[model samples]
Target chain A: MSTIRIAQLSCGTEYSGVQFEIESAARAVGAKIVYPDVSYSQVKEALDRFGFKPKSTQLQLMIARAMSLADRKFEADAVFITTCFRCAEAALVRNELRRFIQENTRLPVVTYSFTERLKAAQLLTRMEALVTIVTRKELLARERQSGITAGIDSGSSTTKAVIMENNKIIGKDWTPSGAVVVETAEQVLANAMKEAGVEMKDIEAMGTTGYGRFTVGKHFNCKLIQEELTVNSKGAVWLANRQRGEATIIDIGGMDNKAITVRDGIPDNFTMGGICAGASGRFLQMTANRLKIDIQDLGAMAVKGNWANAKMNSYCSVFGIQDLVTSLGEGKKFEDVAAAACHSVAEQVYEQQLQEIDVRHPIIEVGGTSLISGLVKAVGEVLGEEPIVPPHSQYIGAVGGALLSSGFL
Target chain B: MKVFIDPPNSMVLFDLVERFGHEPLSSMAVIQEKIDNIEVDMPPMNVTLDDVVRGLKYAGVEVPSGIRGRMSLWGPMIEAADAAIIIDNAPFSFGCVGCDRSNELTKYLIHRRGIPALTVKYPTDEAEAKIMVGQIKDFLGGLKQ
Candidate 1:
């Protein structure tokens, strides 16, 4: 297929990550980026009618397709499209484009604002630590020996990104994933590339996954993508196999959870976890912030010997806090209580898994909870072993992504 | 389509408005409400049309069909300003004085117009107006083609 061409339509003004994602995800695959805007006057009119529902929708539909008629000129095999949700300035225009996308374009048209993609990426990582990520090395030598491949996995909470030069980390960077997922992700990759001193053209193939993937995908000329899950798997495996070898990946994020089994150097048996709030990294992150603690220190604190019984009880984080405070009032140590909280999560997770399949080996925690030592220990104690937390465990999905782009497995 | 810009409040005409008897925000509110409904009523003053035109020129706006002498005709003056912009708070008109009433009136002047009139709040707005002038020039470029 001709270079994978992706398109992003956003608040023609705001800084969204769609462009950045396309730049990083499509780098190895030789992809191209396209940002299209409707005629300015048409866009203005669309925005002016934003107050009127029918008029807004009609205007948005028109604006969405305003300049999209030119898509025929591009030699693309598949077209991924994205728009901005809170584009107050371009609200009318985007509605028109949204309508146009709904009407035409058969390339599995996944249409959502960048915000949705950010949510989905987060959801996918939460469901499972994507075990197989496409990776591309910078050079033939490095590509063969180092098996270095770059994967830019831009999700909602944070940008989990990595670039491998020789199976050795050339450079890695993570930033708060912006509202513009693709654009910010790509910018992070660009920054990583500069920090690593790797030229952009050196990137052999690019694979973008998650919600922001489509908008970013438009910018990449080629990539291997089907859905957010597939890329997450590819991403998880590429990283999990490195740390745990046989990877039974669990990536829990702010919104969801996922479980995968990779055996014989391939994803063999896999069952995605149920949609659970307790399973997400972001929820834990918010909790940490609520408790007034830096998230990075959670694991270290869990390692402390003095254990307070965790006050958190009801699965909801807000109610869980009162549960935690009550435990403290009853005289439980913070470490013990936090660890117990972790145990509860693990028990809840394990219970859910028992409904699906037998518990496998090498469960790697990925996401916000994975970093909390108390939680990791609590869950591990229930599961009979401490789950492995690797360097950049939170970035497993992105690592798997780089591996996927590499065409390594 | 006539538009008048009110200068920033720190000017002499503000005092004139106070001298003429009108509340600032009330005047602004009334003018805005009127403009929203697309209506206009000009208040008479001792200020001459020559004073307005000469005053406009000093403020860096060259009005089309410049007004002559100390003419105080509000109807034709508003008519002359119908499609044109009246610069608010011109350096010459308001000078450096804090007159609330007149300042508010000047701001309302642009809104009083049925056409689009904008206050140059930021340098960017001014730049945009200049850009419109340049764009018009470019549009005229096509006639040569």
Candidate 2:
């Protein structure tokens, strides 16, 4: 039987973890995911053709691309939209695009709102359910076939590899990415291959996605390379599949922060901040080092301490470390100081990146930083609501890459 | 004596006014006050709907309403000045599209006010800059006399 095809649209970022989950879910349900060849220039062309001047804001550009995507030709049974939450612009754009799709096409459209607190089980259930629903009508139309595929996600901090056979994840491996990304990608892929008991000849297809994906793909000679935002959004939605309403995906990585709004099951819009490490995991790591504490322990210490009154006002990581030292010398308890540090990062994100965005509830936290219990707690306190953190959040990107190889060759 | 300066944020004019021992009236102070008291996570201070209404009310001109709102903000400052110095073709002075009208109205109001006003173009070369400074010095000195 011919495999069902799903077209994925998103602003590609490497950290969101949505792409991995969507691919996995699609593969499990006997479907193939395809990405469109839409670019900003094409979007501009479409806007010009429609007599619309280019807008200065990034959200407007993304919306323009989405509007143009509707007119472009591609073969797919369904359309999925993924975006960040709390984006006022995305909310406005999504409403317009939803109407455009309704008026222009008969294909089923589903939008997933990705946030930092999305659960893997919820995402998987929804994806599996989507696949079932999409494929149900054509069940007797095609013959079923399955094979093995591999995905490698070479992120800033780590390289992850996952091998899948007939939609189920059979084997996966991850290792710290050191000085040479090429070597790390090779090592991780080798490790995954060994565990899966499969050779290069045995794998049907291979795909690479992440920050270092382009470099790694060139070194390894892999043909299929996907954008990080596309895969991460896909992965996040697949994981948070069960979520029924609007949510924002906040991925705080080592050096960057991503906020993706998922409305329903599709990603709507996204914003990113990474010019400095002040609003990222690097900030927390640096603060922990200055406190002479392990990074992992900072969160627990923060929870026990009361430093709501103490201020760490520096937005630069180096300046923040100085602020931490000054606070400690001023007789502030270590626990309180640490908690305050976490609070400061949260505040910076709120003030800088998310100020214009009216963030929706049930914030889903992802990326490696989401593991920091104290930072999560601080973000909750700042937002005046708790977030959902799914298990194995770091591997969502890698899994999304693997799922991309699903469908007919 | 109060002297009004165009491109209200010009530090050069502000410093010259203080150096010449005069009170300089500009919109920078008002803008700064708004920025200082802004609520966290909100859009940065800019010309807002309220400012437009207030400016229109102050200008009391109905035709060519496009620039009336902005002109109102500068009208009161020009009215209180003993004299005015307008630096033409100033860097970063490409105001919004409607600014031409605002500029026209501002100059008209200053003319009507009947204050001793000096309009100077920003110097391009080092020699022109020196000459421009001399012209400004002479104008202020004449006012002092």
Candidate 3:
């Protein structure tokens, strides 16, 4: 009954599934959609004014344009917008995009963080039922798409190998990060191909993404490679929609932690991890070991936990143990202590993140620690809500990796 | 060559100790809390080098001492090391040496000597790390371009 105006802006290199989901969600929501317009309009205009495209100039310039466009759109109940994924991952571009939006639009700015989808629920109509769309293999295998079209995602701590049969996920594999990216990529390619029950010969026109993708590509071979963000967004949208309704994705893995918002079931805005491991998987794992509990149980237990009054620990893993032990001796309950740990972790992440990421919707937690049910609850509590723990939470990254590798990204 | 391993409880320290010629002592920074999280060989991780003296004496950061001597610096206690072999599985670059220029220089020399420095932080991609390793290898390999 309402006509919501939505704009979906992504760099030319953004993943396909992410685009599709956004478009689809808008269609379902009856929102008038705009594409390729955000704070980056100036850069886009600047590009137009200079009579030079990205290839003619620096990659940074082009990245800036895309971010600007995204930021402008985010100003409107723009749902999800990305910020501070990393300084190295085209930050200036994103800043210009953000600056333009803050200067130009009257819309409330909302960062697409793990909190977005979990919080977007505040806007859901009481009468509208949650609509879930799970593609499984259909989107990944669309016959209309072909020609080594692909996406790649390489994390600092892990490598994901995905194979798509016409953009439909055919296989996926997750491998530990290697000192040499190319060597690991080769291993990923072999593993993904076998998992899809297919062979390397069957693949044509390969695309890749990730920090290691470049090195991996140099060693192995590929027809194309996409940005890691794009691949992750697309895969996340596809995977999230399969279960319940489309929402934002919170991927807290071993190394790279990300929060992707899917408005109308698409990637709107997202955020990623920085140098601090405070809210990261390794930190959680370390804390788990410190408590002598397994990482697997950390989440579920937190969800069931009672309150405790532990001191806020330092971000360092070494410091956290001492703080917790000291708190325990001081009579802090395990539940409160656990909650405090989770709070500090989330606080560490949100500290540098953009303000205004809605904290009331159904947040779909993904990545390695995303499997920790308690962490989700604890993080949600700190953010003022409870997040949705999905099935196949740990495999989401691998799933995304496969889809991108298969050309979906 | 020195290796700077964190979370002193790591097996990596022991592995480094066994593989390398060093006894891989824990960073006086905090062992126990000091144990390395890595999967290498190293010496026993004990003792926490803190700015306890500075915090109590001057309310600032200072250099942590090793079994060998008082590796003095300024500010809160700086972790002690000779050369460093960082093996962090996470991707973090926002580390600072505080105001203890002396100790900071010492740690820097250990890392700058360029033997093997590994560090881990989060939210970074694997490819990026690989590129760095590739560069380091290239430097070490000195494969004539």
Candidate 4:
């Protein structure tokens, strides 16, 4: 098969020196970044279409390139629109071109505002998502799991393996993240298979996901190695039995957080990243350590506490812990402090990440943090609706991999 | 050599460019000329409908007239620039070039002109300010007079 070409439409990439980072990100996913060619005449024609001439020739060229994509003049599987973060005109042009391309072409589109300090690491996930959309469209469209499949989620804090047969989870196992990612995956997969009373040869297909997906997938020769955004949403909606309609899936992970909106089981819009660990499960772990309670018990205690009595700062984790210590110093109840920590993380996720997606009914909260009743309560309270933390929510990535990979089998 | 400064009204960049031995094409000087000349437009309004029409050469008619007016004044400086210095993420107090469209267009033109241009983020603290100044100084020193 030919390489997928993602058309580059933007201004100031070379000036900002982020063009190399963008290229590096694209290359990492085995895809190529192509700048669509346009003639001077085509640029002039495109300027008329905008009903306003831009003073910058680069902006003019961007519009022309977007026009080329819209006219099917370029053979591209996806579109990436980028501009320097400081350029407001480029921002306007970027949004307009994004809308124009989406309206005119069947191609998937992603937009980013890059600074001079932009890195390949920052662009990798976006590039990967674009590549996934291009390469796994049919696979993503599959509605249900069929046949027996095994999936492993190699996460930052824990590794989870799940075995699914005909849309039902037959077996699952999870362990704290170990030193060797592949060994951890192998151990979890073996344990899960043992629980299912099935040998390796009985599994028709295998899939992997999460941060260590590539490493684990390569070692196991898995059929699908996918990013967690899509995988988690697939698993959350499947577990919640909300596969038919609009639903938002929120996964507060150990390192970061993801909020995705699904339409009929397919992710239409998603936002990931928490700007700080203060908004993720890591903070909860710290809270558990501070309270001298098992991580599992803190959640139940948090529900009984009044968050209003022991408010913590939502912006920084350090400040949050400081508040916790201050609250404890002031003789605030442990349950109240625990509740405050859960509420703080929930509020930060709402303020920072949840604003990116339009909130919908039956919000499905997944991930290891979802197992914490207090955190779930905090999310429900912050969102003003009780979220469904479906059974096996923590194994979402593994289940998503199993469900999606079942299509291949 | 003419040097164009983004936030075209920034007196700081204007003074720095002049101190570095380049003619700074400041929007203040250009607007001052327009304000002094009564033949083209009325007082306070500075630019006439003709200037706005001329601005169509730079931006689309769908864009606000404010952007077109600013573009008309800055476009020539961009076209004539031998080099440029753009300060990104500047506060509104730094130099209130209120029109985003014109600011973007000006920077784009300077970059597309293939001139020696130095783009720097606004320094948040004193240490970064020192570093930014050093960068600007080095870039200016390397420019061919």
Q: Residue A294 deviation, candidate 3, in Å?
A: 3.5
Candidate with the larger DockQ of 3 and 4:
4
Q: In lDDT terms, how accurate is model 2?
A: 0.64
Q: State how far residue A171 of model 4 sits from its true place (Å).
A: 0.4
| CAPRI grade, predicted model 3 | incorrect
Q: Model 2 shows how many backbone clashes?
A: 60
Error of 1 at B27 (Å): 91
Task: Indicate which candidate wins on DockQ.
Answer: 4
lDDT of each: 0.46, 0.64, 0.47, 0.83
Tens digit of lDDT per residue, candidate 3, span A82-157? 3223222222223334434434553322222122122223212100111111112233322233433323446676
Q: After superposition, how far is residue A226 of candidate 3 from its true place, in Å?
A: 2.7
lDDT string, candidate 2, A239-338, tens digits? 5552467677777877677676655534444456533687788898888888888888998998888757566888788888888888888889998898
- The window of 10 residues in a row where model 1 chain B has the poorest summed lDDT is B57-66
Model 4 misplaced stretches (Cα beyond 4 Å): A36-75, A84-106, A358-362, B1-145
- Candidate order by lDDT, decreasing, is 4, 2, 3, 1
- Give fnat (model 4): 0.04
Complex DockQ per candidate: 0.01, 0.02, 0.01, 0.03
Clashes found in each candidate (C-alpha, N, C closer than 3 A):
106, 60, 99, 3
lDDT of 4 by residue, B15-118 (tens): 88888888998889888988876566566758876576456556544446777677788888889888889898899788867876677667756755778888
Q: Kindly list the per-residue Cα lDDT of model 1 for residues A93-172, writing each as its tens digit.
A: 23334334433543212223345245333223322221122221121111121344566766657776677765555767
